[model samples]
Target: MTVRVLIADDSSLQRSGWRMVLESQPDLEIVGEAGDGARVLAIVRREPTDVVLMDVHMPRVNGLVASERILTDAAVRELGAPPRIVLATALELDDHLAEAARAGVFAVIHKDTDPESLFDIVRAAASAVDGRAD
Candidate 1:
């Protein structure tokens, strides 16, 4: 099955770069893109997203908070299964790792992670949501 993905980052360049990498894969599809956590929330609520690759810091709302909201929102939870969220950060992630896990994030990776690794993580997240072993 094609994995529907949403890319959320504040930088236009970052979003574009991720889009290019993800779209090159046959099983992955870029269903939506967002510049901040609030837009991410909106898109997740409206779209049938399987995985969310989100930046840790964003304007309006941050990735962890948006993740928490998505995990706990009754309306969102009722929509079959919630999309798997993978957090990405340019800075040190040590302090946020526990909180991200608490918010139901599937995984966290540094923004500088290589494209192949990024693809692996996203595909793994999608597989987890689908209850399939990767």
Candidate 2:
């Protein structure tokens, strides 16, 4: 099955880059894209995607806040399960990382993360969605 992906990032360049990288894989699908966290939940709800590759910092709302909203929202909750949430942050592991962890987001991948590491993240997020560890 294709792993449907929703790309949420403020940078147009980074969104394009992420699309190129994730959609290059045969098993992944670019379901939708959002430029800011404000648009995120609405898009996700509209499509009911499988995974969210989210950038932590964005205008209006941020990934961490948006993620929390998505996971706890009644609609997504009633769907039987929430999507896998993987944080793609440029920031280092600080209190935010722990907050994300506590929020039960699947994985936290740095923006400068190597090509090889992306696969590991994708795999882990997929596994987490499959009812495995986050």
Candidate 3:
């Protein structure tokens, strides 16, 4: 099955870079793109997304807060298996990682992660949407 992915990042360059990498995978499809957490939710609401690649640092709302909202929202929860969240961060902060885990993020991807690893992460996260992977 093809994985529908939403990209949430403030930097256009970063988002475009990720789009290129993810697009190279035959089973992955980019469903939406958002510049901030607020936009992320908006796009997810309108699109059928299986996974979200969210940047931790955003303008309107941070990824952690967005993740918490997405996880706890009743309407969003009703959408079958909730979309898997893979947080993207430029810094490797333990506190952020802890908060991400508590927020129910599926995975944490460093900005410097190799393209192959990014693809692998998203592939695994796609499976997570069905509760098939941990």
* lDDT (10s digit) by residue, model 1, range 47-118: 888899999999999999999987777766667688999999989889789999899999999999998999
Candidate 3: worst-modelled 10 consecutive residues by lDDT: 72-81
Clash number for candidate 1: 0
Best by lDDT: 1
| TM-score, candidate number 2 | 0.89
lDDT of all predictions, in order shown?
A: 0.90, 0.82, 0.87
- Model 2, 19-51: lDDT tens digits are 898877888888899988778888877776778
Question: Which ranges of candidate 1 are over 4 A from the true structure?
Answer: none
Ranking by lDDT: 1, 3, 2
Supply candidate 3's per-residue lDDT for 93: 62
- Reference-based TM-score, model 3: 0.93
Candidate 1 lDDT for residue 30: 96
Q: Over 4 Å off in model 2, which ranges?
A: 130-134
**Inter-residue clash pairs, candidate 3:** none
Q: Model 3 over residues 46-107: C-alpha lDDT tens digits?
A: 67789999999999899999998887776676666678899988897665888999999988
